[model samples]
Target: MIAKAYLWYGVYIILNVLTIAGSDPSGGAGIQADLKTFSALGVYGATAITALTAQNTQGVTALYPVADYIVAAQLDAVFRDLRIDAVKIGMLANVENVLAVSSVIERYKPAHVVLDTVICSSNGYLLLEPCALAALRDRLLPLASIITPNLHEASVLLGEPVAADEVQMIYQGDALRALGAQAVLIKGGHLLGNCSPDWLIEKSGHTRISSVRLKVIGTHGTGCTLSAAIAALRPQNRDWTNAVNNAKIYINQALLQSTRLSVGLGTGPLHHFHAWW
Candidate 1:
């Protein structure tokens, strides 16, 4: 009986991360990628799916958003049972879903929240509805511990064109931080250069984490993976900057290792289990 009790205690002590996002049937992005990332980083993953996508390496063909009440119920179920250590949010499809998630965040107040502003898919399919942008910016951004936005999403939030260069990215990062996120990570994957730079903006200052751009094609789900990694790492490190840096390093490695994986004809996904293999 004592041995069984210890075993249960050990199971209960494992770190748990909740990913609230859309579902990707291809297992390359959305909740799929987030779950892979959490597992790769040694954190147990739970999920509250907000949408479902018929997507693959090529592109997103269709999206079906889950009902708001169902989304809320999923979150409630997770929080009430599991002691969630961190949360990573992605791909909220509409205003109702956004508001539903926002209300749950306000209630649970999870230790770490990484919001990956997935406005659109890489293949130019709109993931978040146009009307939901206002609710996301107003209600969700403030509750997040960090907001990770790619250059294009940052532009959408800022109501401007894409940042011209690294300087403009920094400026945009600051502007995004002002919108209420405790920190902003402006990803530079779209930037044309030999290096990919991510600008981290906080109230204290900003940091530029630059890595040599890997010449690889299978780079899908990089943003989702990065944010999920940060969420998983933040609770252990307790420093947003370090968490971001570590996540970047992990992503770089994943990109490098995933080059040979020919999953699809178009853009492919990062090798989430690169470290393990």
Candidate 2:
């Protein structure tokens, strides 16, 4: 009876969601976006900052990367005590950082791992070097349960131009699977079309979801938040497909609700708090 009481008491302790990503001073993307999305979805978030960028809604002006050892230390500290339920990985600014993060992930082997292949910014700036992308493809791709990459990043991964269309996205999805991701989500926001289709493909099959184009500008952190939401929901024991779909619904609702609200000077940030109020 005493053992049962201890078990019950401990089971209700803090729920931690881990995120590995960069930091945006503007609070629109990277670790900030992931944490906000996790909290909005009723989960606790912890982060290992990979890089620091000085940027606003307009664009990134400069970047400062954290030491690789420090990145590893953050993960070590978090996994030591926290009952981390899931993990979301974002921008790894360099090759060394990517390898370090991959090593930690393999060691801990968390319940769920979501990889956001943030190789570039929305404004056409390269976030990672060529070597870093190669490291991610070789080291991290196989470890991730699911990887979310926008068009530009996908093109870089596949070594071919990914057409911004259904056929192309599916083709690239298959290619990503070939690269060894357990699952892949190819975001179609870069496509110049009225309907934006996000493809979620896995080893079993493929699923495509379409949303009306959000007319709002400055939607900097939508991808980061969406991926984080998926990571946070994995603790509910839903499969990858369900998790991705639910995350899409959450992001679409958030975008629709905050279509008119402006948070930054340039390319506005998503209205993350719209539903909270």
Query: For candidate 1, lDDT tens digit of each residue in 52-122?
Result: 89999999999999999999999999999998888999999999999999999999999889999999998
Model 1: lDDT of residue 228: 89
Model 1 stretches with alpha carbons more than 4 Å out: 1-12
Where model 2 places Cα greater than 4 Å from the true spot, the runs are 1-14
Which digits, one per residue and each the tens of the lDDT, describe model 2 over residues 174-246? 8998898999999888798898888888888888878888786647788888888888876664587777767
Lowest summed lDDT across 10 adjacent residues in model 2 is found at 1-10
Question: What lDDT score goes with residue 26 in model 2?
Answer: 89
Query: Residue 172 CA error for candidate 1 (Å)?
Result: 1.1
Overall local distance difference test of candidate 1? 0.90
